[model samples]
Target: MEFFAVLIAWGAVQFWGSGAIVQSDDWFVALRRSLRKINGAVPRLLLTLSPLLLVALVLFLLGPILFGLPAFIISVVILLYSLGRGDFHIQLRLYLNSWQRGDLEGARRHGEYFDPELRTGAENALQLHQAVRKGVFYHGFERWFAVVFWFFLAGPVFALAYRLLFLIARHEDSEQRERDMAFQGLYYFEYLPARLLGFAFALIGHFDRCFPVWRQLSVAELPSDDYLDQLGATCLPGVSAEEAQDDSAFLQRASDELQAAQQMLSRSLLCWVGVMALIELF
Candidate 1:
């Protein structure tokens, strides 16, 4: 199917988004960010926990074209859609701009983009400003990895899953139980694919360095299910539990500490794309 091929190409195109590229990705970013802004913790959590079958049904209706859509058109749409919207660039600019202008107050205001609950406080005070910001970060990951990863593996299935999972994650309240259920599934869904993505990163970047680090990440208590754990174990060497926990804890605290995690993530994205390019060339 051309659509399927389109999905593959879309998956392969992994340009690191610069300040200039933000406007182009405005669409997908906006769609997700808006849904997330409305959903918040309770709602989004519920959506993630929903039954996969139910999730499938919803995805089919909205993203049917993904499976059946023409490759050429699918290629165009995904690219158009991939451009981030929402407050991601706006917020990024705000924070960056504030820092550049020496606007501490401005920067603090911008920093509010992080999740309020998780943000609890800013020993820095800047990162804790908004839950939506976590939304921004989430959207960043969404467009950058989550959406495209699914698209390549199963075409429309990816689109449907992201939408369904995102919907569940976006809901709230008396429905907390439902939200929890939805949230739970997402944890399971990304289990295998996430590590596969990690492997792709290792392949593309400093393959030697990346592989060893990824092995370390496998044992590192970052998060996810047995599938993820198994994959990590198979691909990565091993790490002491205590040390991995410490690594996880440290990464969780300082966003700066996450530099390694970010590199790991980026390396994965770049490698996956580069590999796809190679496959297509062959």
Candidate 2:
């Protein structure tokens, strides 16, 4: 039943579009903002969130008792909410389109949506392009893979908890200390799942190159972005020497690589679904 719910949520997002599935004006953001206004320590803020989470969990737990076949509804609602409210691919497409048109300003604007630290004047075209790719890869994990991983690991409650922690961690205006603490918490939450996704990327894409990259990395030493970038790069087939040298050809090649990376992500997701199905069967 959980697996079926996962499929339904994934299908809705894929066909109906995430924008339709997740409302723009969600209470989660408001709740985060209200907590930010508390002017307390990070621990205090986290403590404040605890009861809210507890209430949500209680409600979800009661769902099965109160209604018939509640798993599907609860799972779909949580999954839809946990996934990115906006369209990641649309953002990527906007960046790529602006980039191909030689509109650096437009490209940088859209690219910063993925990577807030991106600076328009700081990096060259190739560097900026690579940064966008890395941003997309990591953001995809946060928005999709991480949420799904938690859902299967526990249920809707843990999935919601993971996303709440993510929101608190990634909130823009929070104090540096609070943001750091939240991000650290999120890092721990995602530690194992990121590795799993990286391994999946290896299997679905270029096994030989990606697997070694996956195997060689120590969790203590590597940050998530570096791990994702190195493994994702390995999975992609490189452009020809001529394509690399020419400016227009280079942009085209980069676009293709980005598309290929997206495809790899999709395949890895399907692989997860297959494994979960097998587990259910046995």
Per-residue lDDT of candidate 2, residues 139-158 (tens digit): 87887888888888777677
lDDT of 1 at 7: 44
lDDT per residue, candidate 1, 1-282, as tens digits? Answer: 423454444444433332233224344344445545444555544333343455346545555565634444433454334333344445566565554555546655665553334434354333332233333334445554665566555654454455456454543322465456666766665655566665664664557766876676755645443323333233333333453346443223333322333444455666666665666666
Name the candidate that leads on TM-score: 2
lDDT of 1: 0.47
Q: Per-prediction TM-score, please? A: 0.52, 0.88
Cα lDDT over the full model 2: 0.75
Go through the candidates in order and give the clash count of each. 38, 0
Clashing residue pairs in candidate 2 are none
Show model 1 residue runs off by greater than 4 Å.
1-87, 102-105, 112-120, 125-139, 197-210, 219-221, 224-268
Model 2 has a clash total of 0
- Where is the poorest 10-residue window by lDDT in model 1? 250-259
| Residue 78 alpha-carbon offset, candidate 2, angstroms | 1.7
